[model samples]
Target: MCGMLGGLLLSAVLIEGKIYFSETFGEGWQQRWRLSTWKEGHAEKMGKWQTSAGKWYRDEVEDAGLQTAEIMKFYAISASFEPFSNEGKELIVQYQAKYEKDLACGGGYLKLGPSTEDLSKFGDSTKYNIMFGPDQCNAEKRTHLIFRYGGRNFLKKAELPYKQEGEGLSHLYTLHLKPDNTVRVLVDLDKIYEGSLKDDWEMLPPREIADPKDQKPSDWLDEEMMEDPADVKPPDWVESKMMVDPKAGKPEEWDDEEDGEWDAPKIENPNFKGPWLPRKIPNPDYKGTWKARIVPNPDFSDDPDLYKYSDIGYVGFDVWQVKGGTIFDNIIITDSLKEAEDMAQKWKALREVEDAAKKNEDEAQAKAFEKAKAARAARSKENKAGDTKNEKKDEL
Candidate 1:
């Protein structure tokens, strides 16, 4: 009911400020399923109605709609533990989940591996399997289809058809095992991503091989002997490679007129100025940010009101100062322009999620009231029938 009111197909439930994708679909949308947490006494309560540690969850919210790419996440919960003492040992990770109902309009993928702070360390070198289809897949020449893979790059992995009947789902997913074998990924099927599979999975590459000598093991192993890569440290090159180059764009340029020597020139407009831009409004269920800003009005010669500098003219002041003001908003403050855009997208998504959650709560309350009213009416009818039967029996 919250989903219907909020217009969310697959509404994510935020419990204690944490978001979770509900893995339930079909006619009976009363219950939700998700991974269990590993709290004290959770193992025994996992299968129980209220104490399941890592088993699927049953949410009280009803179906609103299907979720789109606006929701991205990384989560993995497994009861089985594999001890890892091998370094650079190759392993495959796989899991199977059944779709209860056929989704006519939905898209997403699944990935498994180590996790980084912002999905920066994911890669194809790790074994992985993903199946993204429809718009999410972003295939060159296909529509409404699925793409499968075992690597970060789709081009380097396998692709498969993801179409299924009403209750059909895919199986046989595979991912590489890293030295720090702990796995993290966005296993939700109703989300999309723009980056490679590793980014989509939100997994970090292994920091260190469990066994340094096992870094390039002779063979790949199945999931049976897998271990967690929690105690590993990233190799030297990984840290060095991941470092951000401070002088990335300030490369020295050779001036032909200066005898082919390299010299770094200062930027003309180092302090960028721009106007405040507005963002676009997505659907109620949308969960991405949108932003735009008006370009900053520079005190350049172009503005007739401001003192202008001509191409060949110079100011004739002996000891005068020239200064003006510039206004900009939603511009690059610390990160890149693209990162700012991404932040806007995330804000938009958060708004959508909040709106959806509010709507879902309202609908659930209404449904509860309706059910209570119906139950009360049925009880009243039964009471009247019993009164009549008692009177007839007394007369006999």
Candidate 2:
């Protein structure tokens, strides 16, 4: 809508988007989510999933999410939903994750795949259609955005940096995949990467390959600048960079054959010029570079529906975590960009409340530390004064 408001023109866009699947984990999350029984016998290595708002939040109910409840374990969990394909429409996959503890290594990502009859069997071996999220282990950190094609997973070539330092704070990870084969990756609503799938991923064969029959000629002069035939090295230029010192004198103890001929220690020659050659000019016979002529790749075949997914009925999380306190919530798969943006408002509000609360807590801790330091200093000063008085009395 466009109108004149107080002599100033204003316009507003009210756009809406469709939601394919959404999970808030508010109530009955256990019924909706299924935990994998991987390593069920190994009690020490198996991790568990719990729901909570963490230690701090503006609204605990709204902030509640599924969190990796233990440290140093492998956690695999998933949920099943009605299967649907993204054929001609745009696709948006977005989620919210927060690390409540220092994340030494882990993944906070999502996987979309086929619907399963048995949810208990979902594990690492299960296949997925799309895998997107933040993965960090020690110093290695990146958001994994991978797509499956031809029964193989192809990771995006573009690396999206993952921040492991923002502990206890929520982050938004969004991937916008358009039917046009372009993708936009965003973190906290800020676009980090935007490019086409055909260029950012090796999902297809090369359009052309080097022809085996084409070869460089035997006399092909490929070098742009070669030693000039007309130009020659200066006659005075010496091949040796060093020579016998002219000022050095051999010892007077003369023994011609017994001690061998006395030779002066070699020193750098000041008059000697280094290796010289003719200055390079443009080559008249350069064929640029002798390259094998490119021919159409026999395996090359274009896929018009490269972005389409036939069936994406299930979404799950399958990863290994050395140290884990990652909470995941507010996952949504939709056909509308505006819907994801609107959902991000919840995370933004949560962040504002968290920042303010953390600031207050830090200030209170600092004040208490300063007061304790002052008391310790005062006690030391009094003890020193008492010691001096006692020493004077002893002297009297």
Candidate 3:
């Protein structure tokens, strides 16, 4: 079994594919990556990226990747590569990421865009061909795979499912856009979704739309039900909820000249009916709710190259993290599925070590918590005894 698995790994590594841009965040990474100056003028509001393997990892130096170093700040950075166009080729983007702390609200996504002179000016508004990654805030968990067409970014209409991989542990994301306009997303080696681009996103104009000149007729009876014309109030029906008691007598101490006249107390009328509502019956003349006429959209056009990005020269992370500790590494923009899988194998080996470390840390935290709890209980007991001793002295 071991020999067979090794052969498979060898085959994956040997599969031919083109790698456009890749980064492992090795030494001198600061020279390759440029941080944005969008928030530089502000006082201490900008977040910076640094290399790390975090508190626990498989190999400190080997696992080191660019991590957001500051808390409660925004981070923007990008690395440029030789400009290339994936007009007729398969495109695959893969990355390894870890939200070491406060994954409560932030994105671990990256974008591919064209090269620019001022990397310092790169910010959230920077236009890009594709934006793919994991984003989370509060209860929403999304794997964003957006395609930009005609200056508008379109997200997949169907939600891509996502799950958390615990704190301090790394996760892998792989997005593949095929030459056939099909796409697939994988998280931690698990295939999450696979479908066509045109079916999943609104990149082209809709086939049909509501007619602008059409209107519902004024005489249309849209109501499905109406009050029954035959239904009427019965002559014996009582409207009063409560009534004066007819059998009660005035008090014996009552004085007619000095006191006001005595009145009987009220009691719920047994014959009373609750607020009356007319019985509903189906309207014979009812036409269902009116709708405008549908017509073909004038702007409707289809393109076969929705999956293509004309130019991809830069890979960047433009993100705002309230409490940042997200580490992004092993980024690859390639054209081979096998190449991406081989990288995934690398992450698998690293994750096994990280998971074991996370388990040990969690257990240690639990044990420390128990010890603190016992000490607090002992102190409370001593305080109660001291209060009792003082009470006895006061009694003397």
Candidate 4:
């Protein structure tokens, strides 16, 4: 499956040439990137952003990517570049993200937008051309792929495939948008969704729709079955669900003033029959569901270049994290899927090594904890014995 998807992606974007922009955070990344200190609701409190080369996996740490402060409230940060257009070429956006603190509620996504005069003022209100990546809060875990169309942002109509179970591991997310108005989403280089933009998003009204002039007749019988006219309820059938118990009687010694008023006990009725429902028979006049005839939608106008973005000058992370420890690295915007895949392959190799080291560290830590617990138990037993001896001496 991986091979097949890789082949398909290669065929799709291999024709496109140069990379528009790329960021690997090699050195002096702080100078290139800008951090946002914006708080929720324009509140006084704000989150601070910091860069890190090490990622925390449980107690183990591996050298990699940028991380937010461990106690972040709400954070936003971005990096800007000169405007570039992907007018008639495939646009590929790929990045690696890891939530090392097992993100319970947060967004580990990035946004692509046109140039803003102030990168420091970037926040939720900033207009973005494309926003894609992982987001999880409460029980909802989704991969958001929102695109700005006309004047509003629109979310993809189809269910986005996202990683919901794992954490502390880096996953590569890649978005491929072609000039033909089609898009594909890949996680770890595996294609999760591939469909046309018009079919997946409400970017435009459908090309055809049910005719407004056509309507179902008032006497149309769409029911598949009807109550049997010949069937009748038996006279002996009882509908009551409960009845007074014949064997139950009030205690003779009961005082009306002190004790509650005597009453017969209620029990399940032995002769109870469920509410009578007439038997159903096939409806001879039944017609299947009525659907109006379709006609070409007058409002729809095709736009073959819907996927093209004229200017995408900045890429940033505008997210709200409950428990922050997400690392963002290796952001690349290119016109080549092959370049993205090559980068992904490098990250995948590094992830495997990191995962193995983390597993070993976790195992060693668990063993050490168990050994310390047993030693503590022994020491506690000796202390208790010494206290008992002192108490005996005092008693004597």
Which candidate wins on TM-score?
Answer: 3
Sorted on lDDT, best first, the list reads 3, 4, 2, 1
Q: lDDT of candidate 1 vs native? A: 0.27
Question: Best by lDDT, which number?
Answer: 3
RMSD of each: 35.2, 6.6, 6.2, 6.8
Can you write out model 4's per-residue Cα lDDT over 57-102, one digit (the tens) per residue? Answer: 3223234577776554677888888888888888899998877676
Q: Give, for candidate 3, the lowest lDDT window spanning 10 residues.
A: 1-10
Deviation in angstroms for 357 in model 2? 2.1
Write the number of the candidate with greater TM-score, choosing between 1 and 3.
Answer: 3
- In order, what lDDT does every prediction score? 0.27, 0.80, 0.83, 0.81
Minimal lDDT window, size 10, model 1: 312-321
Counted clashes in each candidate structure: 50, 0, 0, 1
lDDT string for model 3 (89-156, tens) is 77888899898885678888898887777788788888888888888887888888898988889999
Which 10-residue window of candidate 4 scores lowest in summed lDDT? Answer: 54-63
TM-score of each: 0.19, 0.74, 0.79, 0.77
Misplaced by over 4 Å in model 3 are 1-16, 210-220, 236-275, 290-295, 363-396
